[model samples]
Structure formats: structure tokens, C-alpha cells
Target chain A: MSNDKEWKRKLLRDMVVIRTFEETADKLTLRGKVAGGMHNSSGQEAVAVGTMSALDPKDVIATTHRSHHHTLAKGMDPKLVMAELFAKATGCSKGRGASMHLADVDNGNFGGNGIVGAGVGIAMGAAMGIKQLGHKKVSVGFVGDGGMNTGRTWEAINMAVVNKLPFICLVDNNQYAVETFIDRVTGGRDIAKRGAGFGLPSFTIDGQDVLKVNRYVKEARDRALAGEGPTLINALTYRYYGHNVGEKGQYRTQEEIADWRDNRDPIDRFSAQLISEGLLSQDEYVALHAEVTAQINAAVEFAEQSPYPDLSTIYEDVDSGLLGAKS
Target chain B: MSTQTETTRNTLPSYSEAFQQGVREEMYRNESIFILGTDLIERGGHFAQVRGIAQEFGLERVKDSPISEAAMVASGIGAGMYGCHPIIDLNFIDFSLGAMDEIINQAAKIRFMFGKPVPLVIRATSGVALGGAHHCNSLEVLFAHTPGLSVAVPSRAYDVKGLIKTALRAPDPVIFLMHKKLSGVRGEVGDENVLIPFGSAHTVQSGKDAAIITYGYTVVTAQKAAAKLAESGVSIEIIDLRTLYPLDEDAINETVKKFGRVVVADEAPLYGSITGDIASTATEENFKYLKGPIVRVGGIRAPISAHPQSAEAAIPTVESMINAVKKVLAY
Candidate 1:
């Protein structure tokens, strides 16, 4: 919309890479190559890509179990992320944290948390530090609809609001948390409206649209950096697959899933919009998809060839002083 | 406790004041160090362990938090992850149960799980002083059982100052347990700037007939027992394990080898207590040196009561330590 062709292309490219990375991760998880459960970020690509694109590289992010897309969008190396998923020594966490706990603090990605709404407090703490250090950086915490209901999330939001920390509590309301629908569990079913209880700029937005997500996040970032306090955003989106890779998804209807996947797919909608706006060509989109697919495949190869951590190093990194530095 | 050599003019400060002195010194030394806890700013902490710190370092660093222990702890973990050394003050150690998930799952494991240093300290006032079940809890074993957390239980003013300074500078999360009863207890404090390394044992009293290994408030009880036992010609050695996680196995072994009889005591309940760890280490590491079955003196397996007599009977007393020492010396 702003006539920034290169920037639009880059956004599209980042989303494509996330989608490819998630899809490949799903395949690997399905094939039993990756250990443990993997929460795919396939349908929620716009949330991670759009939100990350709105912030500076120095800004930090704390995400949830469904964190592959966020990790890639946050500028983590695909090979390192893939190797982490593969539980290899070459992984970002050195094979310690698999799918659920992927973190690279040096890259400003505080890492993916397994506990619901846990990262919100972490992000709040980072914001507290940022404010104390007088840094103009923002910290974003990504949670699901279920994580929104967590008591600590509200507690953290209240503290952030009171302290006016540069924080953003971004909720990806994918309509379902595991097998339960959000409405079935959440009372009143309005996550954003509750933000007024703490007196902050809070709203719900169309998460499937990249531009809207980016714009909202950009405004939130601006408010945070300006010392206007925290923002709570509930972005409504959907998941294309089950909660985990191997679930039957009996909790959701096939028609509903099909409708979201076919009609409301974020990447497809954004690509179409980009093409119509002359920001991207159909031929270029196809080439970009192929390029990202090849990159993801190469990452898989690197993960496959990566070595598992040695048994002798089981106790390593438990104490920082024991290991002079990270191996 | 004659441990660190006298290098500067010694001052007699209460346990709580020494803790504040340690925190104040560290806050001045490190700009990244900040404190988050309940009643820290207005009430100056329930135990006054952080008294005058808010005025010294400003409210931004020594900030008060709501009653949300979980969020407070998680925030500290997050801040520590971001290169800020946060001292999360849980007013009472019993209240730490509210944030077990954050403490065990997040703070304790994040460093190991993420392969990054979390320079954070969880400061809590521990031990029973007729505070009842809700207030009296010695969770040293619970934290000591968990890996990646350095547990420091300082009984004296000197150890409180030095150990806390070390905890503030630790590259990992440290559970700094201060005794509630010892808050007003006065003791000799060492140099203001020196730090006491964790895992080192302080020899409270030198003896040869028997050894009583203890920490926290139990150290005082052990000292009383040693005084009584010394009159009976059973010279008992007292070893104060300043930090429990790095359990000072070498010191325990040395004491075991020298005395050939041992009694491990702790204020926590005997079931799943750090006393078991100390007793096991004594037998396991110094089996040949031991002359008798290692006796353990700890709190009774029951909820600590508010009644003064019942509370006194709940945790290890001077009489209990005397019995434990005598039981081991029978060999």
C-alpha cells in the first residue's frame, strides 16, 4: 500500500520461508525423524511474520510451543532451528531443547516456552530491563487463546501496565486450545476487552492479513518505545493442522478446517494481494516458493547430517562456571 | 564461625542488617542488578532484609511487586535471561510453593535448557518461629534436589553477607535462604566487600570425638549441643554447610574421617530432607572412616504449629541435636 516494492517482497519472502520451514518440520515430525510433539505454525504464519517485520532486530520476542514460524521470522538460522528440532549438538540450544524449548537469546529470541502464558512474564521482565537500561527496544510475548486465560498473563500485564514497561502481550486466538474451543473454556470470550481492566491500548485484529498485523504491531511498538506503556492485542487466526503433529483433530470439524485452509489461508491471501498490487509477480512468487523450499530442504539435510550430543556431555551446561563457555 | 581470615575491622551486625548490607554493596557494584518482590518499596520488605535499599538504589531497581509470586519469579528469570541480575525476594520461603512451576520448570532449568547463564537470586526468609504451617517451611531439600540452582543457607551474619554477595554474582540461579529467627540474632560480620564462594563448609567448632553437620538455623542448635557434649568429654565438631546444593561433600568427608562418628541435622522435616543427603554422603563417601550409623536430627513430620511449645518441638532443638550426637557417639 505504501509503494515499497522491495519491502513488500521481503515480507512475502519471510512468510514463505516460515511456511516452508513449518511444513517441512511437520513432515519430519510425522516421519518420526524429530523427537517429541511439534505444534505447527502453518496457518498462523501471518502472525509471526507480520509482527516480527514491524520491529527492529534488537527487539526481543518470547513465543509459545507453536514457535517454529516465530523462530524463523525472528532471524534464527533455519539449519540451527532444524538441528534443534532434530535434537543434534549443532542445534541452537545444543540439542538440549527440542521443539518446545527452542531459544537463542543472543538473537533476541528469548526462546519458545512450553508452559501456557509463561513467556508473558519473561517478556515483562525483559521490558523492565529495557526500561531500566533506557533502551528504546520492545519485548513481545506470543501466546495462544488458552494462554490468555492464564492468571500469570493477567498478573504480568497488570505489572507491565503499572510500571509502563515497553511490552506487548500478543495473543494468537486460533479459536482452539488443544481439543477445547476457546468459547467452551473462556468466560465472556473477549481477551482484548479485558485489557481495559488494566487501562491499556487493547484491541482485536484480523491476524490472517499481514498488513493489518504489521500495522497494529508497528503502532504497539511505537507506543511502547514512546514510554506510553504496554499493549495487548488478540489477533484472530486459525491452525491448519491438529494441535500436535499426530493428533486426529476430532475436536474440530472437517468443513471448518477446510474453509479456513482453503479460503482464509494467510500466505495465499497475502500473495494474491501482493500480486494484485504489482508488488510481486506470479512467476516470481512461484520462484520464491521454490527457493524457500530448497533452502528448507538444505536445512533438513544439515539437521540430518548433524551429530547427536555425546553421552559424556549430559551434565554439561548445567552450571555456567563448569563449562567456560558454551561448547 | 572461624572460616575466612580476619582482613578488615569486624562489625557486629544483625542477620537482617548484614543481608541488607550485602544487597546494598552488590547493587552499587552492578548496574544490571535489580530487585523484584512484595512490599520491597513501601514496607521495605516484611523481614527488613531490603531495608534502606529502595532509598539507596531508587525504586526502579528495588521495586515492589504484587502478591503474584509466579509472575514475579518468571519476570526475574526473564530479566536475568536478558543480562539483568534480578534478586526475586519471596518474603517467606513457604510462599515459594505458589511459584513451584516457575521456580522448578523455568528458572532452575532455563539456563540448562537454553544453554545460557541466568544470573538471578531467589531470596527468601526460611525456618520456623511459631509462624505456623503457612509460614514455616524449610524447602532446602526441594531446591537442592533440583539441578542448576545453587542453594545457599547462611545461619550467621557473616555468611549471610558474604554468601549473598556471591549469589548476586553467580552465573546461575541461586536460592538464597535466610533464617527468619536469625534476623535479629547478632554475629560478627567480616569485610564488607569480600564474597563467600558457594560449596565451602565453615567449621563452627573444632573437635575430634564426633561431627555434627548442619546448616541454617540448625547450626545454632548444633553449636548448643556441642557445648553441652563438650562438658561430657565428647568433643563434637560442627560443620556449617553454607551452601547446600554444592553440598560440600569434601568437608563432610573430612569431618567424618577425623571424628569417625557423624550426626546430620536440619530444620526441615526428616522425610526427603537435606539431612538424608548429608547422612548418605557421609556413609557413602567415608564408609571406612565411620564408626557408627550416622544419626539425623530434623523437624518432625507434621505441620509446624503457631503454639510456641509445639513450634519449639516441631523442628530440631538443642536437646534433639544432643540426643543425635550422643546416639552417634555410642559407637
Candidate 2:
């Protein structure tokens, strides 16, 4: 196989892995295996995979509550994330943080925040530190349409621009924030324009197209590393599930959901493009799906077998330095 | 005689000046230490607590943030997570409400949630004397209620200098409450660098009749009241609790047992106040030693009015402390 084929195959495999993981998470959540609430990123695979593919190993990312795809894309072990959802001691954060707070700092993924737009300032601060330390690295904050309406997001953008920090505000414009549509809540349809108002170079891209997202994110990363301040990329996509697992999603019509599922599926589009371009074969696609399914199944088995954290460790890790010590 | 000699050797600086000196020393020692807030760069902050810091540490280290308190505090948490020490100035304590989500949710819980240490220090000017509702508030009780945050309300210049240094170096997030009315008050701060650890209380004056537990500018008021009561042979022990969260329970218990009477004073609202917490703790722990009911002198349960008399009536004053002390003595 050629290098181009290998790259395409890898991207396809990552998207498959994300889809499989999120699908499994949705099932587990319904089965009452995963506590709290699970925010599944079933249809927004390309946004996570494409943007993460553009980042270097040292570059950092701060994700949102709906961040399973981002975690898998940033190279976190599937088993560890599954174990975290299982509330096992071996999970990331030592089972202290569940799905909404999954973080793997070793892989430069700062973790997902529960609050909307909360990660914006954190990513900007990390970018400011990177700039001050003279490191050629950028930080990306993945926010939802709900996060865009928050004042914290604009404040962070203004600060990033003023400080000329290396940062990217990736607004995953999935149309709806919970039940309310973006058009109903937001002042306008264009989320990227908010960044431009802060003097940032902003653009809008089709989130379903992996190639376009990868290209635009790579360009944004380049601009950031060159000390050109921050860029905002509003990736328009759709969610396959409700705001969280277990909800019937009574807000939208069945026809709209079916339309996105049939016509705008990121995986189906990417696979069709690959097969048409002769970069992938039908046999390879079937094998890739099998591989991802097996990988997800093994992760689920591992999480099911893992033990819960010890009750004695409840007070641990409250403060990084003073763990188990008095406040 | 020894206390007088120590005071003679120490430098006399106002609370604001002591804060400036402490920040300057820490910034000089730690390259990663930076201060950011509104009007901090050119104006040296609203109270001038960070005056001349930008000139000394360069504008890159001392930054002036926009009027965005939420970002200012959240950025501190982020910077601290990345191994940089950040000192964020909330222009007024009342403005902290604008950044409550950042302070109550993010800064206070991120370290615990992610299992990473965040050494972020927030300096907020608090009190109800000089300003109305918008500018004046003593919200240390709110911070003390938070699990991961350490709250310090230093009353004296000496304690402010030491506490600020200690807070900057602490492994946990800290909220340093500076009293607005005490900013111009001068006190003797030792020349040698010192760090006052959190959760410790100092006995401003030792007496046998009753214990007046207080913090922040109220400590000053308690001291004045204690002196006046001493003239009337009504002795009172004043315990200045510099830190609120890891409250010096040992010191409080000891004083409570010694005096057998208690009066808790604070500038916050009377209901659900830090003084109430202290009174509850003292009563629950040392109920046998109590010679009278634990009295509380705190802010009235209302918004601080702009009128001078109403403002004076809003918060606890030296007169109120004396009245509480006298009432407790009568018990």
C-alpha cells in the first residue's frame, strides 16, 4: 500500500474507533453500567479525529463535556477511558473523575470540563504559558454551540488576541444546545464571527468532511505556532444522540435525524471518498470495522472486570501536593 | 519590653505597602510568579496594592486584564495548572460574584477533579466602610465554605505580608481577603522575610474574662474594644484568626476553655456567617467550659446602604464588639 493509502486507512480507522466507542458508551449508559450521564459524540467523529491529527504530540487540547471522540482521537487508551466510565480505580484520574472529566495529561489532553465554555480560559492560559516558555506549541479548546454564548469564551478570546498567545477556539456548531437550536439561541448562525470580533482570524468549515477539517485545522495550527495569535474554526456537524444518553430527544423531528444520519454521516462519506479514490478497498473497510468492534469489546470487558476505587482513597488527590493531608 | 524592642527593629508599612513588598519579594524569587487584574499594569490595581510591581517586574509579568473577572480567575487556575504561580486581583470582593463560577466551580474543584495541584492566589479587597453594596463585601465565609479553597483574612500589615507570601507558595488555591478600610492602617512588619502558615491564630491580647474571636479589619475593632473594656476591669482575650478554613480549632478551643465565655465578630452577614460557624464549633466542642451564651457581632442581614449611618449600622463596629463583650460578661 502507498503512504497516501496508509494515511487514509489510519484516519478511517480512528473515526471507526470513535464511533464504536461512543456507541458502546451509549449502550452501557442505558444498561446502568456508567454512572452520572454520558454525552456521546457519535456523529462528530471527523471534528475530533481531523483536528487531533493536525496537532503535534506536545500541543495541548481542552475538550468539552461531550469529549469521548476527542479523548480517543488524542491517543488515550480505549481501555483506560472505558475503565474510567466504569468508575474503576485503574481509570484515568484514578476513578476520581468519570466521563465528563476524562483527562490524560501525558498525551497533552487537559481533560473535558463539565461547565460550558469553562475550558476556554484554561486553554488560553495554557497557550499563554506556552508562549512565555518559548515553546512552539498551541492549545485548542473544543466548545459547543452552548459554550459560544458564554461570556467566558469571548473573554478568553480577547485575552488570547491581546497576549498574542498560540490558541485555537474550535466551536463544534452541532446546531442544538440541548433542546434549543443554535439559530433560536444565538444572535446569528455564524459562531466563527464571534472570534473575528475579537480580532482573531476565523473561518467556517464542513465538520462532516474529514479532509476539509484536517486542512483547516492544520492551517490554524500553523498560524498559532507563528505567533499570529488565535484562530476560531466553527465546524458545522450534527449529533446522532440526544444531549445525553437515555433521553428520547423529543425536541427534533424524526425526519431531520434520519436526514443527517443518511446524508451527512461522516464515516460513510469518508469511506465512500476513500473507496472512490482507490485509497481503500471494500475488503479493507470490512476488516477495519471488525478491528474497531473487537477493540471496543475488549475495552468493555476490561472495564467490567476492573475493581472500584478503595473507599479509603475517597479523600485523596484533593490537592496535588497535599494529598491525604489536612486542608 | 521585648515586644517594644521587636517593633523598633521592624519596618512600619501600611497594609497596602506590605502587600506590595510581599508580592515584589515573591516575584523576584520566583520567575513564574505573575500578577494580573484590571488596572494592574499602569494603575497598580484599584487599591494600589500592586503599585510599582510592573515597573519592578516588567509589564510581561505584571499584566492588566480587561474587566473580565471570570477570565481573570480561570486564567489563574490554568496558569497554576501549568506550573506557573498566578496572583489574581479581584478589584473588589463584591465583584467576585461575577466570577463565582470560576471561583466556586473551576478554581476550587479543578485540582481535586483532575488530581493536579493548582497554586492560584486571589487577592480581593473587602469591607463595607468606604463603599456601598457594589464595592464593599466580606465574602470570606463563602470561600471558607468551599472545600478545596484556603481563605486568609489578614488584619495587620505584618500578617498580610507573611500571609500573602505563604499563600503564593501554598500547594492549594487561596483566597486572600484584604480589608479596604485597613489598607491605610500602618503596622510593624519585620524586616526579615517571613511566611505565616495558614490555620494559625494569634492572640492579640490575653485576658481571662472572655474570648473575642475575630478576623480581618474586625480584629482591629476587637482590639480597640478590648482595650476600652480593660479600663473598666472587664478583661477580654482577642484571637485574630488569620485563616478561616483550616480554622485554628486548637487555638479556639484553648481560648474558649481559658476564658469560659465567647464572642465571635465578623464583617459578613449575621446569618450563615463565619462567626456563626465559629460559635457553633466552640459550643459543640467546649460546651462544658462555657460560662455564658456565645454572642455574635456581624454585619446586618441587609444590603449595605450608601448612607453613612446605615453603612455604619450594616457591619460590626468597635461599639458593637464592646456591647457584645459586655453582654457576654453579664451572662
| Model 1 lDDT tens row, A213-256 | 99999999999989999999899999888899977867888999
Q: What is the TM-score of chain B in candidate 2?
A: 0.95
lDDT tens per residue, model 1, B1-331 = 4544332224467899899988888888899999999998877898888888998889888988888888788788878888899999999989889888788888888878787888889999888886688999888888989988779999999999988888887778889999888898877777766778788889998887888898988888888888887788888888999988777778888888888888888878899888887888678878998898899888899988999899999888888888888788788
DockQ, candidate 1, comes to: 0.48
Model 2 deviation from the true structure expressed as Cα RMSD, one decimal place: 2.5
Across A200-284, the per-residue lDDT of candidate 2 in tens digits comes to: 9999899998888999999999998888889999999999899989787678999999999899999999999999998888998
Give stretches of model 1 more than 4 Å off: A1-3, A322-327, B1-11
**Model 1: lDDT of residue A219:** 98
Q: lDDT scores for all predictions?
A: 0.87, 0.85
Interface RMSD of each: 4.4, 3.3
Go through the candidates in order and give each one's DockQ. Answer: 0.48, 0.52
Which residue pairs of candidate 1 clash? none
